[model samples]
Target: MSTRTIQTSAYGGMNRKLRFNGKMKSREIIEWLREAKQERYYTILKFDEVILNSAIIAEVLDLLRISSRHGRVWERVSLEFCEGPVDLVVSSLVLMDCVRHLFLASDKIQDDLMDRLSTALRISTSLKSLWLLIPMTEVSATHLGSAMKYNRSIDKLSLSGSNWENSDDSDSDSDDDTNDGSKSLRPKLFGKQNAGNSPVENQMSPRDAAMSLALGLKYNDGIQSLDISCCDLPDEAMAPIIDGLVGHPYLEALNISRNRCRIQSVEALGRVVEDDDCLIRSLDLREQSPHDALEISPLSFALRQNRSLEALRISHNELVDSQVLELVDSFRGNASIKELDLEHNNITEKGIPDLTKYIKELPSLTKLLLGGNAIGEEGFNFLESLEDDDDSICTITEEDLRPAKPRSTKTAKTSKSTAAAAVSNNVSFLTGIAE
Candidate 1:
């Protein structure tokens, strides 16, 4: 006995949108296909991780073909933790004139199945978004990169959590929820080498995968948003990908968070932001390493010259007070950035004065997320006072407002003097930036 869920949404009394989830049976699928042929409704079908044989695949394909031949089309299809058989089903579905979005999550992808998927990607003209949250291999990465070079309809692509080195002997069974099925369950981003006959072929370094992807992205013109976070790509690998995205026509968002990108990657990213023709709006560098004053200098300098980037996220990257001050001073006359996320860093009362001054100067900055930091009471009070204005700051977390730990005498005296001046001068700062 299998459970199934079907949700329907009627739009403007014309066509219905139907979403089907859970493990479906053959008889039930046949009945649903018969009923769907008579109705005008779009379909979003999601398959649970069940043993899908050839018969199930044929019936599902027939159902999609019938719906597409009618006025109704399948909009999205998802397969969670399934294997090559499911991959073949979705690959066949992509060749249809339906399925704008496809999500496939698996523990392992064979070379033949990846070849089929890559062929479908190249031939599918209607697919808009493709997410392959699986343990990717070098062959699969090369195949997908080659496909993207010829693909023209895909707008959003995410290949996150492909840092898995080997898929052999790895268990795919899990009780975890697949709500946000893009990420993997692994704790570390490092790849593990497993013993095998073809050991070298079984291992796909994150950097190699990224380099293959860069080759494909270099020629792709239609991709708008790219997310390769959690892939453990260092500077050498990420530099090539950043070069591929240098002058993209429609690219607006890039998320490279949780990697090991160092000075070279940061400098390359700074060049991308500094380009006058750069149209990128959102840059997410969350949880990247070594964000001291020197490592962050390249980006800080680029921010002073960049006018296209709107949202910058550097959260949980171990930023200290001096780095925060450098960032604030860099954004003095910038007009584009609206959201700045500095949460979960080492910024405290010492950095709050410069932040307060910068906030007063940059009118475009509306939302500031400083939660998870030890900003202490003084920092909290100053930021809270600014909240009197509408839509000025995000809700400060309890950690941001909590009392600071005791500092050394000289540091405490300096922080206290800076904070008192900032607090007392808040009157003029508020007045000067008043509407």
Candidate 2:
């Protein structure tokens, strides 16, 4: 909109950089760069939801490209290609190493562009955050996997809106095993590479991409927050991600929701929760419903030992009343969990007794979500009772998250006077008895 819409201020940290965010034209951007003499600048410069064409994109990129080639640096700039000439966007960022935060989204994306972005990430040691909501298929996945090997600073990654239907023949609903059970239906990941060839010669499958990412994660310690939600990964691909959770200490948030994982793949998650080595605090396994408690047994058992998990979402898993009872029972000694989402399960009034028992005893539970089931009016009444019941010891975050206020000195003086008067009356009665 307005070329005068720029906001600027000084930010203090180890690196005291000037930060600015707003929409501006290419000419305005050039003006700001020319006026500013600082080496470190955090600029979020772009139009709001503007669907730009190739010419506009080229003009903007040309400005940025020319500035960078002339030794100008944008320390932490956030760039989003609204609608650009696919060809220019890649080249626009090639030597712009100062560009760290990136957000790319498009209806239709080209392969070479995807390859170029991957290549850029290989050298983006300054890149700390990247969100590719566009359909890059295996290209983004493999490059991201490979980046973990080289880049040390790029930690936050979001590959959301990835539909595995990147291929005309791609079907994620296929079974894990072939007819003889000796081979996997999905393409094998990283088979012994031919001596002179490379892994890129064959386009990486979704499974291979996942494995490559996870394999790189095994040796990596930089990535902490990973959101691979809705990235059409098959059951086989889901395995490496689970296995990658084995030894990572800095990984605090992991969301694998809506990936449609199988029992075998989820068993790996069980191992991760059970292992004391992994430091994941927030886990989202929603929509990957396990049929019975047996499917959830590993995590149920792991809960007894896990002290780091704070929020767990197992909603839409169709858990029976017995399963709910088992889940509550497993949380007996656990005090770290603040939110337990059991929404869309089969929990009913029959399981309310066990639920109430642990709700009072567990000492750390705050919010218990039990919506979306036929749990009936009776189950809700049970929850209502939990809220009103003063005897409930736990539910730490619910009613008694903070300590009681201290008694006033004036009240203490009043209590002392009242106690003296009662003692004097008692002495009179004792004196009469003595007489």
Candidate 3:
């Protein structure tokens, strides 16, 4: 169907799409906000690296607040900036009346923008959520740290940049027949500093940025959740952050995924988690350590002793049956941790029964996510039989669990091998939390 036809049927013939030329017009945005407000619908403005004029943003935001007062738009509007932009921030929009979820690519943010952001974070009471994609400069990081020092408005601060972004291009049919294999390193930090910039100005070392964040966390009260996924942090930086997070009053959720966090550093955090005073409950330690066997013992031992943790995600760390058994043993008869996420692990059917044993031992087991495993139909059925209802296996995928079949055609085999070779050749380019 045509877009106009779809809109006519969906919105009673209302025009919501905005066509921008050089700049995003405030008048156009104001009208969109008004229409969306009157209809009680959502309002979203997605820009493709377009230049965002502070005047336009401020005017639209002010108009949006008025529209909400007159019964238009939802409580929050989404402004997402994909693939960093050469941005300019005149002043912090913190004084703006409307609530907005802002996503800014760290690599794309310019110098002036950082200053404005710091100003906004320092004073703006309207900034609800902020997402800073990695590769921001040290100055920007320090400014961010200063902004979050005492401010209590922001609830979520995310810097998670996972490898393998969403791709739309079609794949070429090629295959690799050889058994030659190699492990690809995690995604590296994005973007390079402009020429002539100082070392600290080039890109903020995760360690120094983390130290600044630790300073902010010491005084932070409003932000309750923090995500630093794919942000490279050496042991020196990781250790301090763990030490700082021990008794943080407001921080309840922490995502340290893909930070090159080793078993030793995690052990330090685990020791703190054993404390009854720690407030953090929801934790995502997915792909933190390189060695699965090393990761199992320390964190599991900590979980067994902790009393506050309720939800844990530990996916993509190459967990085998034995390691999973050790983890399950830690959770067995535990008082906390009702939800467990074991996605992207190397688990198989042999470990299912051991994991299931905890279902009866601990009455609080509510949800279990087991996708990206090698479980077949029987394995899926067996897992479904664990709990009284099948609702707990929401993340389980039967296709991922099924056993691999022999190639039925030469062409198919060739294509598979070719893709593997392509990945192998370009593996060095793939970015991760560690450079």
Candidate 4:
């Protein structure tokens, strides 16, 4: 952790500003200095953490000829907290210098810090990539919308642990009734303020904002990758978001796992995948189950039109025999998709013949996940047949089928001994099978 010192010109034409460039190896210092100076003097200055102080931030703002106290230098700058509240203000001023990439993670973002952040967003037009790890939970959507309205530069935004719910126990009595209904489980809209509150609620759920921002990106051409996992959104909440993504040409990857999204959303998402102009390359919708069985008819429609999608993941759903057969059949003509994950489903031994029949039609199928299913020894034999060079229609080998064996067999008894023992054990637990 040796600190490397570098002298560079400050943003306001201040001479020989002392800045610490950490952990430079022995011979790389000269190359680093040359590369550092190759950019505009202001760009170099903004990267300098020493210039992130209030005096230097003010000087940089004035030098940029922006009169507002809230102006941005670059989209990103890191300032370690060495002091108190004043340091936080200095950091905000530095952030205001530009708005594209802002990574402000400190212990100070509690009550007053969010207010400053809202102000910063209002003034920072170029801000795109925002990673704020703060404690503030009551973020007003109006203020966030106001900030995002003029500023279209943000493509990736991540906010952690900001889902602040009401602290008052008065709402406890309403919890049971609210929890009883499926309608109450819908993802709550953040940034909407309670009546009479001047400041917006800090409890901006990341998933809610992610869905909004993703919808917003449909009009905006800059955003490409969106990761909103662990945000606590349900499948119903994602349906509209998926619908909004039908024609987006710029979006590439979407991760919406570990949320409450279910099979219905997946079914709806299949429509987006069917669009010819859709640019999605990877879609992750794991850990969401449908109220009923998962259907693959919509996915078959997607496979017919979507040529750009390279990977499709729909793990942890209750996929039945017919659904698996339909999905495998859909991939027969789809050469673009290389990876397919169908883990934690119920694709049985009875479905293996149909599964392999259509799987053999996919020439580009590289990685296949069939774990936590009921594919038996006969299914494995069918998979092994695909390993041969003469079986040019299928490219997967015995190695690809090896990892999926043990897990799928835990429930299904392959041998007579195991089956008899299982029946006996169940009988001892319950005398009548009819029970």
Best by TM-score: 1
Ten-residue region with minimum lDDT total, candidate 2: 404-413
- When sorted by lDDT, best at the front, the candidate numbers are 1, 3, 2, 4
- lDDT scores in order: 0.64, 0.54, 0.55, 0.48
* Candidate 1 residue-wise lDDT, 291-369, digit = tens: 4322777888887877788898887677888888788778778888888888877888877877787777877888888
Q: Can you write out model 4's per-residue Cα lDDT over 91-210, one digit (the tens) per residue?
A: 345354543454443323244555455566545556556544332333433334334444445665443212223223233222122222322211221222334333333344434544
- RMSD per model, one decimal: 12.3, 20.5, 9.4, 15.2
Clashing pairs in 2: none
Order of candidate numbers by TM-score, starting with the best: 1, 3, 2, 4
| Model with the higher TM-score, candidate 3 or 4 | 3
Error of 4 at 309 (Å): 1.2
What does candidate 3 score in Cα RMSD to the true structure?
9.4
Deviation in Å, model 1, residue 111 alpha carbon: 2.9
lDDT value for model 4: 0.48
Task: Give the TM-score (vs. native) of candidate 3.
Answer: 0.67
Write down the TM-score of every candidate. 0.77, 0.66, 0.67, 0.57
Q: Candidate 4 — which residues are off by over 4 angstroms? A: 1-152, 157-215, 290-292, 389-435
Which of the predicted structures, 1 or 3, would earn the higher TM-score when compared with the native?
1
**Stronger candidate by TM-score (2 vs 4):** 2
Q: Which stretches of candidate 2 lie over 4 Å from their true place?
A: 1-42, 47-95, 166-204, 290-294, 388-435
Screening candidate 1 with a backbone cut-off below 3 angstroms (N, C-alpha, C), the clashing residue pairs are: none
